[model samples]
Every structure is written in structure tokens, then in C-alpha cells.
Target chain A: MTTAQHLAEQWPGERPEAARRLLLAAVDSFSSRGFHATTTRDIATAAGMSPAALYIHYPSKAALLAEISRHGHATTLALVEQAVAGEGDPRARMRELVEQFTAWHARGHTVGRIVNYELRALPEADFAEVAELRRRIEEAVKQLIEEGVAADLFSVAETRTAARAVTSLGIDVARWYNERSSESPEQLGSRYGDLVLRMLGAQVD
Target chain B: MTTAQHLAEQWPGERPEAARRLLLAAVDSFSSRGFHATTTRDIATAAGMSPAALYIHYPSKAALLAEISRHGHATTLALVEQAVAGEGDPRARMRELVEQFTAWHARGHTVGRIVNYELRALPEADFAEVAELRRRIEEAVKQLIEEGVAADLFSVAETRTAARAVTSLGIDVARWYNERSSESPEQLGSRYGDLVLRMLGAQVD
Candidate 1:
């Protein structure tokens, strides 16, 4: 599927369809124009609504960004959480987590790009919450690496740095992922899973 | 030892002191507010110049971005080139490349973040030039990995993916390197160098 199609399926939070359209429109504007440069009118017009109609869903453009940021963060956090929540060997768990995380960034790259890179655009007050959520996401990955090391499944020296490297592999996917590339998200994720395991000195099968 | 000091030392790129000040201002503004959100006025005012004074150095804000983008890209490419030029071995070359690349991103992170993330804001024609430069950078890493594989020094399965992961580790440093985090750029680069060799399945010494 295309990035736009995949983004519509992944994000949008719990808002109604109409509000979801506005959020998606805001994402498109923010993705292309940068959040500060994107006006409410641009979002509204993109959503096929009157400028005032946006206020019915979000009080301000910042609110719109906050919603998208919060929802995207929550969704990604839950994905990592779920990836590690299952019962399995830590090696299997690490591979699964990398696969899921990498695919999320690739499939939902539009929202992924904005949510990953546009952190500064959120209001400072809103940024605190979003940052806390990201902190949790990073922690989740760190825990996985720590587990792998504890079980003797991985031989990583620095758990924190290895965790950051694993997370970075996925996050950077949004920066340079081209759907037209021959590699599918699943293939990329699998390769990344292998690479992460190798980085930790875990045997890759 | 600060990111600012390192940036000044690393990337002035033959411009006059006055023009260098403007480019630095552009980097700061683009780093925080992003390319589209920042006005030429903001850039000029940040540089302690009148609005029109910016035009004397660069024709347009886009021109300023192109100059900054091109210089930043070329600087990074040159650093990577120099790292691999006089290397002892392919594995050593790879480690040195990652070390320098990671340090460059960490130390010059303000400009690094813009050069790494703000490519989308460049005009299509300008982006093409930047993209070609980036392609060459990636190819350099790819060549190093291929060399390691050919010499039986590394056991990477996919040279291209391994190369991309090595590059990603350094590029993402720009996004999350915090001076307050206790890991200096030198320390981070050292750790990253070790980790990268491990990822390439080379023995980490």
C-alpha cells in the first residue's frame, strides 16, 4: 500500500471521521510547510472545511499538532510495549520488536516523519507530555536490550547506547524511506532485526 | 567543546566573517523553527543585521538554505572521505569513519540536524544537488563495508543494509545528542565506533 493509505490506517487517534480528516490535513500541511509555517486556513481548506470549523475539533493549530503528536506517540509506544509484552526468548522478542518498530516507521512514514521530526513545533507545555511519552518509548527498548544481555542472549556492552541504536534504526526510516524502493517494509524490518541482533553480538539465524 | 564552538571551527566554508555569521544564524533558526517557519528577517535579526543586509550575502532565504545545505553536506562528505583516506585496514577504516561521522553529528549537531533533517525544505533543484552529495556519502560507507566483506574481515550478509545502519547510527546522533546527558561527543563516538564494528560482524577490540 501507499504511504498515504497506510498513514490513514495507523494514526487518527479516537477522533470522529470528520475530525480525523482535519488531523490528517494538518499532518499534510505540517509535513510539507513545517508546523509554524502552516496556517489554520491551510489545514481547514485541505480538510474541505471552513477555517472556523477546525476550532470545533481543536481549539488551535497547536492543539491540532498536540493531538497528532500525542496520538502518534501513544501509538508507537504501545507498539513497542506490545512487541516486548509477549512471552518469548529475548532474542525472538528483540527481533520482533525491531520488525514491528521499523515497519511502523516505514508504513506510516508520513505521520512518522512529522511526529518524529516536528517535536519542536509543539507548544512547550504540550512538548513536556510528548517528551515524557517518548522517554517511555526509549525506556521500553532499553529494557528489551537489558533483558537480552541478562539472559546471555546478547553481549552488548552498553545497553543504553545499543537501545538508542536500535531505536535510531527505526526512527531514521521515516527520514529516508522511499516507498518506490525495492525493499518492502517487512524486508527492511527483517534485515534491521538481523542487524540489531548482530550489533548486540547475538547470533542471527 | 560546545556544539557551537565545534560548528564554528568545522563549517565556515570560505565565506567572509559577515556571511559566516548569517549562515550560523540560518542554522540556529532552521534548527529550532525549521526552514519554512524561519523568515529572512529572523535570520538577519539573529545575525544582528538589518533585513535587507541578508540579501547582500544571499539572494533569498532559499538561497541561504541552499548555501547552508550545500556547505553542510560537502563538509560532512569531506570528513567521511578524510576518515577513510588513510585508514590502516577496512575494519579500522569503518570504525574511524563511524567515529568521525558520529562526532561530527554530535559536535556540529545544530547544523547537522538542519542538514540531516531539513532537506525537504530545499527547492527541488537544490535538493537534487544535496541528494547527490548524500548518495556519495552513503556510497562511501557502502564501499567500506563491501571491502570488509571481500577481505573476510567482516561477515555482514547484506553490505548495503549494513552500510545504511552504520550511517544511520551517526546521523541520528544529531537528533538526540544532549550535552547534559553525561556522554560527551568523544565518548559517544568511541562507543559508537565499537558498536558499528560489531554490527559489521567484525571483532571489536
Candidate 2:
């Protein structure tokens, strides 16, 4: 399956049917309209439920957003972790890491955009948890760069800043990605991987 | 003066004080709260005016946002244009381009964040105009990269993609910048210039 299709399927969370509908509605609403602008009624309507039906699933819009944020971050963190799991040359590992990260952002841009851009809208408590997931994502990338440096495959002046830029190249993909755009998620992922490898002064194929 | 301070001073549009106050309020509201979530009432209250008073300045909240976007784009375009002007070496030109672009995003992040991220929020007509300005910005960068390649000073395989990535490195800076952050705008601009130069395979001094 295409990466975008995979992402589409992943959005069908493991909640009950009613709750899933509400969550899906929240995703659509929050992705297009800012979280603050979307009301419980709008979400309920989108999900084909009554206004109060939303209450049974989510207490408030913020709660709904929190659920979405947590789920998105957790899933993404899992993807990043999985991307880095296989053993290889550190350079190859970094390539896989950038490819997968970029693919996720391109394919799952709605949730990715919100997860990366809308942290302020999440309640403070949820923000902390989501931020932790983000930190781990950064650390995963950082560790790869550090490993590459130790292996002498990469010549980077500052591993931390280089890692951030590498990830930023992927994260910012969500900000511009659209299906109508020319590049496929896989193509974008591969291209960005090469560009980041270039930035690190790695031997680029 | 600091770039942020300079950006802060750039918000006073060619409007009357009341209108400028309304625009400033919109910038704060849109920056903190996503544009859709911020109501006319919120803007007016933030500006210390009644809800009805906003109509005297802007016909609608979207109009106010459009105004801010147009002004912001114009100023940034001017900056980008000037950065690429009077350049000696193509390498030096690219370095200056990245530096000034990064500084703009860092200092003008309050509005830059919105302008870069909230294109979907703009009306269709206004979006077209803003998009054209964006195209010009991208074209300018691409032209510079092309010039460097033609001169054999830079070795980028994909000039368009490389230019986009270079700009993205700076644009994404706005999403995470805070006054409390350790790196000042000038410092960040300098660092990013080096990084882009590195990505271009330019010899770093």
C-alpha cells in the first residue's frame, strides 16, 4: 500500500465505533479549522451524531484535541522508533530515519500538521506529554547523527543543530504537502533523505 | 536594534491608529490562537474596543488578516529582494540570502508564523496574491542557486528542491522561536547561513 493509504488506514483508531467517529470528526475539524474554532456541535454534526452525543465520547473540544494529539504523537513516535530499529551502517540508518519521518509527514499531514503546529491549543497537561513524545523523536534523530559522527561516516560541526535541521526538513513537509502536489510521499521522503545526507556531509549515493 | 524589535516596529500599517490597533490585535490573536478560532469579539476585546468598533476599522476578521498578510508579504519580499541585490560572489549572495531570510522568520515570527502557516485561512483571491509573492521569493532563491551552479561555486543536483529546503530551514525557525530561546535572531541567521552553505557544498571559512 502507498504510504498515504497506510496513514489513512491508521486513523481508524481502536476506540468504539461512536468514539471513532467523533475522533475522525475531530481530526477533520481540527485539521481544517483551528481547534479553538471547532465546537462540540460541529464535531457531532460532522460525525452524524446529536450535539449531546459528543459529550458521551468527548467532554469538550479541548479533550477531543488532546486525544488526537496524544494519539498522533504516539503513533509517530512509534514510527520513528521503528524506522531506527534495524541495524545498518549509521549512514544507512540515518537515511531510513529521514525517509520514514518525511513519509509520515507527507502522508499523514493533517494530523502531523496539527501535532507539530497546534501545541499551544492543547491543554497544558496534554502539551507536556505530547512534547515528551516530540523530544524522543528529536533524540532518536540526534542519536543517529552522533553515531554517524562516531563512525566517521559523517562530518558535522554540531550534531544537535544538524539533527534538528534534518528533522525540520521533514516536519516542515507537512506544512506544504497536498495530494495534488507533484511529488508522492515516497518520492519526497527519498529526496529529503538525500538532501539531509548532503547536509551532514555524508557520502551520498 | 534587534531584528525582533525591528519586526515589531514594522506592524504599523498605513492605516489610522484605530485601524493599526485592530491589526496589531489580530496579529496577536492569530499568532496565539489559530485564525479561525479568533472571533471579531476576541480581536476587539484584545484591542480594547467594543465588538462593533472593529467594523469601523476592518469589515471582517478575514479582511484584517488579509491586510496583515499583504503587508507582511510585501515587507518580506522587499527584504529578500534586497538581500540578493548588490552581491559579489554567488556563495556570498546565498549566504546573505539565508541569513536575512532566517532573521526575518526569527524576528517577525509573530506574523511570519501566521503568514507562512495560515495560507488556507486566506480568502481565495487574497491567497492568489500572497501565493504570487511566495513564488517570487522562491524564484529569487532558485535563481541564486542556479547562478551558483552555473559559476561552479556550488554543486547542488536539484536546484529547486535545494532552494526550497534552504528556505524551509529558515521558515520553520519561526514555528519554534521564543524570546527565551538561547539563540538570538542574528546568531541563528549566521548558523543557518553556514548550514545552507554547507548543504550547497560551499567552502566554509
Candidate 3:
């Protein structure tokens, strides 16, 4: 699928078509212009709706941002959790996790930018909610690394720091990845997977 | 020094005091609220100047952002170049480079965020200028890695991708580092230095 289609599919499928449209528009505006700079009117206009209609679906611009932030965080967390749950040795799992996680960030970079960089603009409660999801995401990666250490599959001085560094490689992709990038998301993710495995001291093919 | 003081000194020392204060204030406001949301008035109020006073120093909000972006990028480039030019083998230089670069991001995260994450808000010409500096920064890192590979001190399938991943580790520190973080900037940098060495397949001490 195209980048636009990938971003459009990020919102929950259960939401009404209009709500999804507004959410997609908010992602575009929030990622491009940032949450603090984007107005509800801009979102409404981008979605081809009136401001009153936007208000009916989402109470305010902050509300739109809150929903987008929650969905993005929750979706990524689910993907990571699934990667962790998959059947593999720690080395194999780490490779899959990094590859898919990095690819997700590259493919959905617009929403990734909003969810990762725009958290400060979120309301206090919304910020806390997203932070909890982030913590879980970090925990999932840490668990994978710890398992690797226990099984003698990896070596690291600090597992927590190692996991954070691993996630950092993928999360920052959102900041820099674009159409002009040299590699496809899959190719980038695959290369990162190799580097991450080496960082973990796992044998690389 | 305190984080605030560290951020304050990021502006060039040769500029007038008033301009420095305004630039510091702009960094605070722009980093927290983002470039598009922050106004000349907000920056002026933060700097204890009137909007007219701010305009006297900076013609517009975008100009303030441009100056801040240019200064931040140039300072980082100079530091990285200095590390590259210093005495040591490629392995030693890479270790020192990652340690210092990571700490710089952690210490001056506010300005780091503006330079790394807020580039989209810059005007066309200003963005191009900053992009040129970023290209050079990447080249410096790539050159170091190339040297390591030439000396058989490091093994990597792609030098450019490795360089990007190495910088990614440091640049993303700005996104997540805070007072609440367990590691000091120095400690974080040191740990990352180790992880990066392993990632580069260099012998760890």
C-alpha cells in the first residue's frame, strides 16, 4: 500500500467514516504543522467538513490530537507485543521485533512523528495515558533482551539501556525517513535488525 | 551547571546580550510549544522584552527559529568535527565522538529537539542551509566509520547505514532524555559508547 493509505488505516476501523477522515487530516496537519500550530478549522477544512461537523465528532482540536495519540500508541504497542509473543529464540525474536518495529515507524512516519514528538502538546491526562503505553512498549523490548541474556544468547552490560538503544534506532526513523530516503522501509528495517543483533552480541549470519 | 544554564549558553557568545536572551527564550518556547505555535510575543514575554523589542532583534518569529536552528546545527557540527580531528585511532575517535555527541543531546535537549525535529518549520532557504550542515555532520560520522572499516577495526555491510544508525542513537537522546532519567548525560553517553562499539564490531574494553 501507498504511504497515504498506510497512514489512513491507522485509525480504528470501528470509528465512523467521518471520524476517521478527521483523524487522518489531523495526522497530516499535526505531523506537518505540529499539534500546537494546527487549528480545528484547518483539520475540518482538510477533511472536507465544516467546523461544526468537526465539533460534532471531536469536541476540540486537543480532542482530535488526544484520540490520534492514543490510537497511535496503542497500535504500536500491540504490534510490539505481538512481536514479543511470536515463537522464536531471543535472537530470532529480537530480529523480528526490530525489523517490524522499524518498518512501522518508517511506513507510518506521519503518525509516528505525532505520537513520538508531539506528546508535550497533549493534555496532562492524555499525556499520562500515552506515557503508560510507552512504558509498556519499553518493557516489552526489555523483556525480550532479558530473555536473551538469560538464555546466553546475548551479552550486554545493561539490558535496560540496551533495549532503549534498540528502540531508539527505530523511533528516530520517524524523524528522518521520507520518500527521498535511500532504502525501502523493509530494507532499512532489515539493516537495523542486523546492527541491533550485533549490538546485542548475538551471532549474525 | 543546571540544564537551564546549559541551554542558555548555546547561543553564540559574540551576539549582543539582548539577542542572546531572545534566542534562549525562543529555544524554550519553540521547543516546548513547537515552532508554528510559538509567537514573537511569547518569545518576547519570556525574554522580558516587548514585541517591538523582539522585532528589533529578530524581524519575525520564523527569523528567530532560523537563527536558533543555524546556531544549534553549527555548534554540533563544530563539536563533531573537533572530535574527528582529535588524536586517536578511528575506534578511539568513534568512542569519544559518540560519548560527547550523546551528552550534548542530553544536556541541550531543548535546542536539540528544535534542530533535529523542528526543521520542517523552517523556510525553504533556511531549511536548505541547515540541511547542508546536517549532510556534513553525517559525512563526518561516515568518514570515521570508513576509516574504521579500512583499518579492519570494524565490520559493517554498509558504512552509510551504520553511520546513520550511530547518529540516530545520539540524536534520539534529545527526544527521551530528562531530569527523571536515571543516567546522567555523561553516564548515558558512556553506555551508548559501549553499545555503539559493539554495534560497529569493534573490540569492547
Candidate with maximal lDDT = 3
Name the regions of candidate 1 deviating beyond 4 angstroms: A11-14, A203-205, B11-13
- CA lDDT for candidate 1: 0.85
Docking tier of model 1: it is: high
Candidate 3 local lDDT, A1-205, one digit each (tens): 5767996666557889999999889888887787888899999999999999999999999888889889888888998999899987989888999999999999988788888887877889999999999999999999999998898889889988998999888999988898788899999999999999999999544
Q: In model 1, how large is the Cα lDDT of residue B156?
A: 86
Task: Please compute the TM-score of chain B alone for each predicted structure, in the order given.
Answer: 0.94, 0.93, 0.96
User: What's the TM for model 2?
Assistant: 0.93
Which 10 residues in a row give candidate 3 chain A its minimum summed lDDT? A3-12
Candidate 2 docks at the CAPRI level of medium
Give the per-residue Cα lDDT of candidate 3 at A120: 75
TM-score of each: 0.96, 0.93, 0.97
lDDT by residue (A79-132, candidate 1, tens digit) is: 899989977888888889999999888887888878878887788998999999
lDDT of 3 by residue, B1-205 (tens): 5767896667547888999999889888887788888888999999999999998888898898889889889988998999899898988999999999999999988788888887877889999999999999999999999999998899889999999999888999999998789999999999999899889999544
The models' CA-based lDDT, in order, is: 0.85, 0.82, 0.89
List pairs with backbone clashes in candidate 3: none
lDDT of 2 by residue, A1-205 (tens): 4433554486665668888778778888888787878888889999999988889878898898888789888887887787777778877888888888888888888777877788887889999998999899889888888888887888888777787788888888888877786788888888888778878888644
Ranking by DockQ: 3, 1, 2
Writing each residue's lDDT as its tens digit, candidate 2 over B1-205 gives 4533454488645667788788888988888888987899999999899989999878899898888899888887788788778467888988888888888788887887888878888889999999999899888888888888888888887788788888788889888877776778888888788788878877544
**DockQ, per-model, please?**
0.81, 0.70, 0.89
Deviation (Å) of B192 in candidate 2: 1.1
